[model samples]
Target: MSNPKPLRKAVLPVAGLGTRFLPATKAMPKEMLPVVDRPLIQYAIDEAREAGIEEFCLITGRGKDSLIDYFDIAYELEDTLRERHKLDCLKALEPSFIEAGSLIAVRQQEPLGLGHAIWCARAFIGDDPFAILLPDDIVQAASGKGCLKQLADAYHETGGSVVAVTEVPREQTNRYGILDVGKDDGRLVEVKGLVEKPKPEDAPSNLSIIGRYVLTPEVMPYLSKLEKGAGGEVQLTDAMAKTIGEVPFHGLRYEGTRYDCGNKLGFLEAQVAFALERPDLADGVKTFLKKYIDKV
Candidate 1:
């Protein structure tokens, strides 16, 4: 029998300085910020693992070592949990929750852009298909399939590039990399073209690329080209655009509610949504919000 293709690896770019959060991010890495109980980056890591991604490449910058340590062996913490007979909590602290050998961190060295950070992992990605997860964006779905996992499922069927996408307002198209959709299969839409922050008049469709992406190894060359675009930073959209006709690129309408945790409003919404979904806090949080809603 022919050898099966290797499972796709995931790359997460957590090297941003996160200047938006200001005082909070000054002392702690923004990706370390807790949405509820777990940190932001943890959600992304969990999502990737759930999708059967065996290896991960975290493109990190300075002041982000805490993220590495968070997933490392926390002996003292684990010991305390064990002594307290908190087996569940101790399990949460298990080292293999994020396998050490499976995860690698590479420094981006500069805040070039998303494309540059992804390129930094080229040596690690090693000419294979890979997934990119942006931790700043949190997604919640009733089903087990998170955004990245949803795309991975689609990739297996299509065997080409897949990006998680959703419809945004036509006027807001400039805020996203809008898609020029050619055909639709209800879930996966064939992408004929892509525009990065194009004016609404020029945008082909309102469908915008979300955070999750299952990309072909061919993207490495384009990302490596360091083609600077919007904000003088290397744009991933630009690279994906180059592969348009050559490779079959499709947009997946991920069935989930995506929260842009990088934004203040989105962060607040994520907190409420997560709180309401928690078995422990759901009732209390719902009661509190119902009472607070009237007063607000």
Candidate 2:
């Protein structure tokens, strides 16, 4: 309806304490943790840009100023590189650059939950449809179109809310927000309901919601209520679930490999997986992996 308002803004909720990373996250933001070479947040930002998001609001928290600084121009470093004719080095920094006024940051002020974190960006989102990309969940698209781009396209066609979903093991359904199937179309499933971290037997379906979401502004009001759900935290899933019948909501089976870099094992696996995707490092990384596996 009304042309879907043309999705342009994206919100990245990076306020988590990242207790899983502990000491490493004590000083550095977890979003700054490099997966292969680029920080995890970079991948999320790149994906948002690929989806035609022109502006971004980073839902940040205390000790997360580094996230903003990472996108700022390093004048001294750039000058030195320019003087030394290190064009390649300067070129490599392009992705980190954000045009003036294109990026903004808002403090979450509390460790409330994802819903509250997204609520903090209400002003930034205004009345426009927007996207939410979680940096901790780095999705590498198998089709070369970032996961958000895939969701964005679906949102344009359907003109409502869309979220990326993938089938997690039924036993692991408790680990994520599982979706209730309404209409099964193979590529997209109409969202009848959303259950945050449901027990295996209670889960409505194996398909679980991931980090990518294309949402209309309607969900913000639900988040504003700040009703604590599941873990006593204001869950974003709950907010989204509230809009199920009001807005056309669907779960998209996106083409991609999602890396949950929020945990230790997943983080390590992402490092190897991403490194293996790089042409410059693939051979060497493969050799090292083979040798290490042989020894193990």
Candidate 3:
């Protein structure tokens, strides 16, 4: 039998200045921030792996070398683990999971916008469907599905654009891409149109866009024409909006809880919630939570 066409690549936009994080992000790429023990980007990569993405195009800038290094082989550390007979540690650091050749880091050069960052990986993406996973948004599913995978499954069947979405407070709809709903089952909602950060009262629907996206290559030209809006940057939401009626744009209500790690409060919440879920750290994290849960 002929092999099915592979979903060959994915673009991860990690070049953001992460200014929302202030002092801490001033020294680190927010993507490297840990949720429990794994870096935020690791979870993003893990999600891509779950969806069978073979190539990872990282749109990065200066001071982001640590992210690339973390996914590379640490010979000395592995050798030490081997010498000390720390089998579990050595296995945990296995190089196989890190696809060195499949990793391509291109310079974003400027923090123009999410669309610009995705454009930075144009060569890696080429002319095909590819997934975009934002590391700043850490998605967790008790149902064992990364939000992006849900979109991918939808894309696989429909061969069109799909985005992760959920209902946000109507007052805060301006902070997200608001979906104009057409038809709805329980899981997938047909998008009649899209709006980028519409004023609460102006919003057509309460559905807020999440970080997961499965887009076709045709969206690249639209992204290239993106004009700055909202934050003086070329918003991906604007680019996605351009595809409204032409593309089969739909919103997948992902069976997961998403955390915005770009903010301090959200990051802390993800760290605490993830720690409480880990078998090794749950007891300690729960105890610490009670100590500070009320007062802090």
| Candidate 2 to truth, TM | 0.98
> How far off is residue 68 in model 1, in Å?
0.5
Question: lDDT-based ranking, best first?
Answer: 2, 1, 3
Candidate 3 residues 72-95, lDDT tens each? 888898888889999998776653
Q: Which of candidates 2 and 3 reaches a greater TM-score? A: 2
Name the regions of candidate 1 deviating beyond 4 angstroms. 1-4
Q: What is the lDDT of candidate 2?
A: 0.93
C-alpha RMSD in Å of predicted model 1 compared with the true structure? 2.0
Which of 2 and 3 is ahead in lDDT?
A: 2
Choose the strongest candidate by lDDT: 2
Residue 291 in candidate 2 has what lDDT? 98
What is the clash tally of candidate 2?
0
Candidate 1's residue-wise lDDT over 1-296, tens digit each? 12324555999999988888988999889998888888898999888888889899899999999988887888888788889999998776653357658889999998888999999999989878899999989989757678888887888877788999999999999899899998898999999888899999998999999889999887889998998998899999999989987767899998989999998889989999999888999999999888999998
| Candidate 3 TM-score over all chains jointly | 0.93
Q: What overall lDDT goes with each candidate model?
A: 0.88, 0.93, 0.84
